[model samples]
Target: MGPSRLHLAQGALAALALGAAVLLQGQAPAASASSDNLTADRVENLRLGGDGVAQRRHMWTIFADMVSDEEPDFVHWQGESGVFGAEAAKRPSGIQGFQRPKSIGGDPHLIGAPIIAYNLFNPAAFAHIRAQGLYRKATLDRLQLTGGTGSVPPFPAAAIVIKTAWWPVAPEGLTAMPVWDPELNPPDPTGNPYLGWARVVAVDPTNISQGKTAAVQFVGRSFPGARRVQLEAFHHVAVDAAMAKQLAGDPESNRTAIIALGRPIAVNDQLALVGINVMTHEQQDWVWGAFWWHDRPEVGPFAADRPSTLPGPWRNYLMQAAFDAKTPRASDAGAHICFNPWLEARFPDGGQGGGTVSNCLSCHQRASYPAAPFLPVTRGAPNLREDPALAPDRLRTSFLWSLTLHAQRD
Candidate 1:
């Protein structure tokens, strides 16, 4: 079947199951009603407050600033010599830590070819998890179970999770290329060496609560919006260009160059704001921010080419959405969001299969602390579709992935 038809079919099944569950529990039908009745303005206001537009603009500015700062507090290096200072020796000690050991080889198959990731959790978010009385080790262990409750509390509004990749930036005067090792199974690094991308996931309880349907509400204490944002920097390219022009540049000197180019350039500027992703409510498809060049007819000279090595469906999806306007109404001053047709088409109705078919929210909804060590779900795991069998019976982690890390001994 075509993508739209498939999505409709999957949504129908989910809606039926959701409706039946609500009816069986004797809940009011109004609880399951769609947010469609609410005007766009009302929905935006409810989620973002009276100054919603200003708040969104402020957020975008903050994110832009964060991405540009060369010495940002949130940036951490993975492995033994990370920015955590002496604390690096202590694994899983701080709120901001690396996910993999420094020595781990990069995943050759992944795009953006990241060698390692430095994950940063805002102080409030870190403290909130600690307040739950669950330590990192216990929390990580608990998350492995297929069922049962955990001591972790839901992430509060404005909680931010930032992950920065360690990829080599492409030097100036060269086409962005992938660095690969033939011996490696994955072949390429985790992120693009020439240009690294940082991804952010922020918790917005106001937006989330306003958009939740009965099915989402029935789960208890879960919020509606979990905004995701991504930023890209051409550290290598910018630095390379600066060095060639000036004749006296090194990695340390190039730091300033990278920061200078962090903002949007007229055309072919090294650094750029990629786009943002937002999900204000459970009933709606996650809003995606297409890159600026997406609206242009030509694939602008600065646009990165899809790596031929990528899987077919993923490549095709990227190509289609490159210049398409999926949600024209979601202007920056309004909802400040857009849809990613490629993502929707690939994932369909969010009923997961494997590979790129994974839905962001659906997959994350399964993020709760397991009671014991069970098989961790792979990237392409089938969607649980909010199946009760797959959901926890009590308190959940509410989609926070960092809570699953094991604490290290001093």
Candidate 2:
């Protein structure tokens, strides 16, 4: 059957650094979110990634299904895996046992590099996938580019490619047909199984570039505890340096990227959003809250001044992920935690649209910018002169007060 009922907001808590201007927020010192909560330490420890041998066996044995250990309605997890792991489903291990493509690039079936994979319960095929698993692995409707891929360098943090899919299962290619079998589907999204919101995460055996077979973490979500629901989304996803500039207002706005999608959302009631690192650099991006969003799913008119929807603990976690200055530009690198107010949503979207506002520019420019997609140089890079101590993170010292909008003319 569909499983139990749950409600997850379509805008699954999204956050990215705004170049170096101040990602999570343009905060003040005291605004630093309490590291105590927000699963900070849990992320710091490397073991959370799980032992490779054991993990592989588990996925194969279970054949990947949407597994969930009930927490209070406030925190119904779809089942936990490594840092960037997804629920167990056919996504990770389809007909072929886990195998990576010879040529290193991206995946045509999923998002990210297929690092960590778990389960995605599709709805329409209730009779097919109901007995177990999150949702059936299938595609939803709409969109231009159906599939794409890229190479994921071995790094400590997990990387994920996200997209909002639809219609759980159809004839094969993208179609417009869905089925909701209440007797077997009420617990899930009727005929919805595994059609939307997933990550093609890259998992390394040794956490090194030359590691072994890269694994996948296919994850999906439904309102953790509440029934089913959907939200609209308007996102402008960008990365690295360009993202930083958008927040700093460096290019005065030209450096920004934008997009809009509308869809229904489900909220788990307890946890806001849960996934793994989509991209990693010298900086370790911790999940931060207290980001600003004008609304859900559908992003509103963005301007110079806007508040963040991200919460506090979530913000600090992202702010803490760091990078070593000496690391090579192209080689594996981690960034110190950074959250861009420029990216609106604070949670993950379950393959729909219209949840929060976002701008992912630097990611598009992955060709030129090195290190982190789009981060600000410590003020004075090639020519522009500025100071490092005055960095928004350094200045605010906290994630909360940092979110405040300021005027240069002052």
Most lDDT-accurate candidate: 1
lDDT of 2 by residue, 26-92 (tens): 2223212353323234433322443322222221111111111121111122211211122233222
TM-score leader = 1
Write candidate 1's Cα lDDT for 1-410 as tens digits.
Answer: 24334545677543233334323323323222242343233434433343333333322323333333344334332322222222423443222232232222222213221122234555544545555533344444545443234435444443444433332222232112221111221212222122221111221212322332211111122223322111122221222343233212223213323422222122222232122223222112211122221222124321233322222112211121111111112222221222222122112122212212223433444444442221221232333564442454533445433333323212
> How large is the C-alpha RMSD of every model relative to the true structure?
19.3, 24.7
Where does model 1 exceed 4 Å of error?
1-62, 65-73, 76-116, 130-135, 139-151, 170-175, 178-358, 371-389, 405-410
> How much is 175 displaced in model 2, in angstroms?
14
TM-score of each prediction:
0.37, 0.18
Candidate 2 lDDT (Cα, 0 to 1)? 0.20
